[model samples]
Target chain A: MVTAKLLGLVFFTCSLEYFSLPHLAHRLFPAWSYLLSAIVLWFIPIPLLIWLPVISVIASSCFFTRRFNGGADSVMFWVGLLLALTYTTADSKTHFSVISVMTIGFVGAFAYFMAGVSKLLSPQWRTGETFQWSLSQTCFSETFPILRQHSRCLSLGILLWQLSFPLALTHRYLAIFYIVSGLVFHIVNARVLGLSRFTLAFSCFYPAILFLSHSGDH
Target chain B: MVIMAIKGLIFNKRTLPLDLLRLFFTSWSFFDRPGDSFRTRLTLYQDATPILEQNWPETVSFKWWQLIFNPAGNDWHYSKQLESCAAILSQKYPSEDFLQSREFKQYLNHILKYVGPKSFDTISVLLEVKKYSANADFQRLVFLTLPTTNKKTFI
Candidate 1:
């Protein structure tokens, strides 16, 4: 229940960020539909059965119209759908089952792993040239002089961290460390790069990370 | 896994069902490639007279509080759409054939509406893309001219 609520709040923030944009509308519906759904998501405590379909329809609208904000939107879609299914299971009234939490954790880990692998395959990223260039394009490049100076080393470190993210499931302390560090990384990206959605979207899965790590402790 | 997801989700021709599935499996390659400069501009023409012009990726100022409700992300997405259309148009297709292609028409329709409530006899969207290498020098200079050119440059 806690995980679902936190995810919902994140979704609400994402939705607001999306619908607030001027003149971007669905092909078949007005932009206000999204605003309305976001209001319902936050103000009204609708049951999972009721809210799941509502959000699914809205998500479908965003997808078909090519308005889905980022990859986090997709992750949230999968998480919400899967959580709805879990809502039908025994003990779901209290909390998600171990399998469900593990599944969510695995999905988050796979996302990070794939990101690292993709960066590894890119020669520009490997050389940190792309990182330097991207930072140079940003408005806040002057704020992180140390980051620019050590771009290659930091890029490689980030690559390794993403690749090893799945190991967080193996131990609680490691999970806590990864989650905390991951939050810091995302927070920095959000503040510097204006990728605030990633901070909220990725954090939605942290609960699963914590849950799985605790389960492994026993 | 990303390749598998793309194969399973995307088809040669897009449809409602395919897009719905694709929504759940968005590509996860964040910053996998070097950042390139691309800009799209729309010029509205009325009976041989260019009236209004608009540039995509409209200017945005980042704020500390915007971390909670940033609209720049959507702006980025729209700019990417313009860039994608520009890429397709750069495939060396004949101007007439490319203009009549379904891809261009769909993009035109969307962009037309996006440009707001304005009626123009014709609209032209130009994409300017600059790709830099390690050396940071210009190469392969090409000039654009209208089909009815007779020693006269469009620019």
Candidate 2:
């Protein structure tokens, strides 16, 4: 389980590299100025550390809200803002920090909702049989020839897992199950199909989910 | 037999000073850029006297300028310079013993082919030279080989 969680973290790190982070950071900060500001921030002594996260969150939010100016950039900017907020709130002790954490959970649920809806709308994914065949071709066709023998079982399991993802968003326990299953899907794909890099890109939601659950326990 | 010959030539007491001078001249010519004044100086020397007189102390400042300014021009001039050096060396040391060794001839042929008309035939020539030298110090010679015959065609 620890290995699985570490694998999931690896995926999240990779996803940040490939996805919106590079463009978003570049857009928010002018290159040299950002480097200068970061250096200045780094040298600020002990007392500033406590406020640094909040200040950064506020600065990022203001930058995104102003610069985004309503297009795909705006959407990416706000998403980046929310990620920053979650990161900052995770470290805070405020009463509303729990709300911030729960909002992060909703963000993960939103991903599942988008994925499940897309799968449902796609005729190929709905058939479940085709999903299995495609999954096998993608994940298991290269290794473990024995997986071919269990093709029917594999196909049905993937379909059921994806189909139930939206429903899982409603309950905390169900959300955990969906998150675990999503992680397993990536791990199986990586191990069997050598799609480790691809799997890492899809695991970005795990941080949000884990943050929410930890905050909820508190 | 080839290894023994190179070892003998390298260590020959009477030839040691000339060899060092040759090595310095060869390495400088091997690494020089086209149109560099040093390259011009090299061609004027019948012996190593002009090379020794014109040799500038190696400095980071000169290297930086050589890299950033007139990079392409320097490359071409250097190849011509190296070819002249090899031709001069072959003329000066025309003993059958020196020319007979397959390795020496191979090195000569490699230098000749590299500095010849087909110098710019392909990118691999530059890559091969870099690989052969095991030193990026000589990479400037690559730019010297860029074909000038069809600049308008390329552009």
Candidate 3:
């Protein structure tokens, strides 16, 4: 089951990147001829249906070019590659064993520590009000601008919640609160601010899966 | 009037430089003696400006680009400028001892609001500047500090 799920994730990611290669290459490669060729290749619908390797070739080329540029582009390319590679090899028993577990653990721990440290350093965050204000401003402001008036109180509430996030690791109730608050936060962001991409990509579905997947085993 | 304008420059601005300065000052304020804060300094300057009018030189001007970028290519120059600006502002408001007061905290908070937020590295630079300079005046310029990270990468 795990192997099938891992393969599914890999295939999905690869297909997405492949399908999006022309758009990605257009942004990376300014040369008109190269762009034209990429577009033509992308539009070759029948071939794409028959063979997946072609998509990989085009995507890899675009990735290499962008990654070599050494800037924001490179960082994005590397992160994308990391995500792709992780998904692709997730089912391989050798790859998924100790290394994968360690990597995920480190990433999870680091993310938690970063959140805690950021809160600790900021006085507003320490006081717990800033979180509430931030949530209202970034999450709830658009759909309900009236909430903007209570930004201070909202920000304080958010701060308190975030400050308590680290506690979730040790306590089940705290963990549940963190997850609930996080889901609410993302839902509000999607519903109010129209930031569906962020909500989908970082907040709601992904983190929930991670939390649930890890909670039982580790 | 010039002193007031200078003080305003230190406080207002929604741009990256102002944000960096706010981070720099806030981090410094954490380790500072309870009395010395950005708010205290600003109020002191506001209250003392009338009296310091004669001493406020008409020729007082800074190389504005220095606030935007460090021409010396050294981060140390940036730190020096921050300290210098704070010192100059403090000197202008000598009467109130703006270096130590609750108003200074307000000033820091106001700057924080305008500057908003920053990532980890920016925070580190602010903390570094604070550690290097014990005086409040020097720390104010910390906002003018720029990110040392290569910008080409999409962080």
Go through the candidates in order and give each one's DockQ.
0.26, 0.01, 0.02
Give the C-alpha lDDT of model 1: 0.62
Best prediction by TM-score: 1
- In TM-score terms, candidate 3 sits at 0.33
Q: Which stretches of candidate 2 lie over 4 Å from their true place?
A: A1-80, A87-97, A132-153, A166-176, A198-204, A210-218, B1-155
The whole-model C-alpha lDDT of candidate 3 against the native structure comes to 0.33
In candidate 1, which residue pairs clash? none
Task: Sort every candidate by TM-score, greatest first.
Answer: 1, 2, 3
Residues A1-218, candidate 3: write the lDDT tens digits.
23222322323332333243331222222222223333332443232231232223233233222221112122222223333344456557665533433343334334434555565576664444454434332211133556555655665565455455555555456556665676676456445433322222222123323443456446
TM-score of each: 0.75, 0.34, 0.33
State the lDDT of candidate 1 residue by residue for B1-155, as single tens digits.
23422432343235556556656676778877875555567776777688787775454566776564566644555546544564557556876776666555545444554555665666666666666644453222212212221122121
Candidate ranking under DockQ, highest first, comes to 1, 3, 2
Candidate 3 chain A weakest ten by summed lDDT: A67-76
Question: Which candidate leads the pack in DockQ?
Answer: 1
Give lDDT tens digits, candidate 2, residues B16-85: 5543343222211111111212111111122222212221111111222222122122223323334434
What class would a CAPRI assessor give candidate 3's docking?
A: incorrect
Please give the lDDT score at residue A177 for candidate 2: 79
